[model samples]
Target: MTDRDRRNLLERRQRAAAEFVAWSDHHAQEQRHHEVLLAQLETHPDQLDGRNAMAQQRAWAQRDQHRRHLHDSALAQLRHAFR
Candidate 1:
């Protein structure tokens, strides 16, 4: 590739890397939030009964799934940018 084309590609890769870092930060925050919620549930099981407990569990699962998806997407983006 020409010098200009190489420079543009490098710029795009840098932008994608920055975006991946941001996504990773958000993903970490989500994981931390999930951990805190789980800790709360463990500490105060009585506070969340029947439907509330089930709902909270489901919410945690969904959050975890979303975090995983974000991680996967970010990895894919990085791979694509490098390619």
Candidate 2:
């Protein structure tokens, strides 16, 4: 490859790496949030009334689903870039 082509490839790789890192950080944060939510549920079970508790549970489930999807997408992108 020519120098320019190599440089462009490097830039693309760098951008991909940065994106993966950012996604990973966000995923970690989400996981931490999930843990905190679980802890809160454990410690203050009475704090949420029946409907609110159900709502909180649903929201946590959605967050977990989204976190998993984002994690998988980021992994796929990183793998593609490496390959």
Kindly give the number of clashing pairs for every candidate.
0, 0
Q: Which candidate's TM-score is highest?
A: 1
lDDT (tens digit, per residue) of candidate 2 on 1-83: 99998888898799898998899789889989999989877676587477777777898999999998998888888788766
Q: Residues 1-83, candidate 1, lDDT per residue (tens digit)?
A: 99999998999899898988899789889978988988867876587377777788898888889888888998888888888
Give model 1 RMSD, 1 decimal.
1.7
What are the models' TM-scores? 0.86, 0.79
Model 1: lDDT to the true structure: 0.86
* RMSD to truth, every model: 1.7, 2.1
Compared to the true structure, candidate 2 yields what TM-score? 0.79
- lDDT agreement with native, every candidate: 0.86, 0.85
lDDT at position 1, candidate 1: 93
Q: Residue 60 of model 2: what lDDT? A: 94
* Runs of candidate 2 exceeding 4 Å displacement: 45-48
Candidate 1: minimum summed lDDT over ten consecutive residues — where?
A: 40-49
Q: How far off is residue 55 in model 2, in Å?
A: 1.7
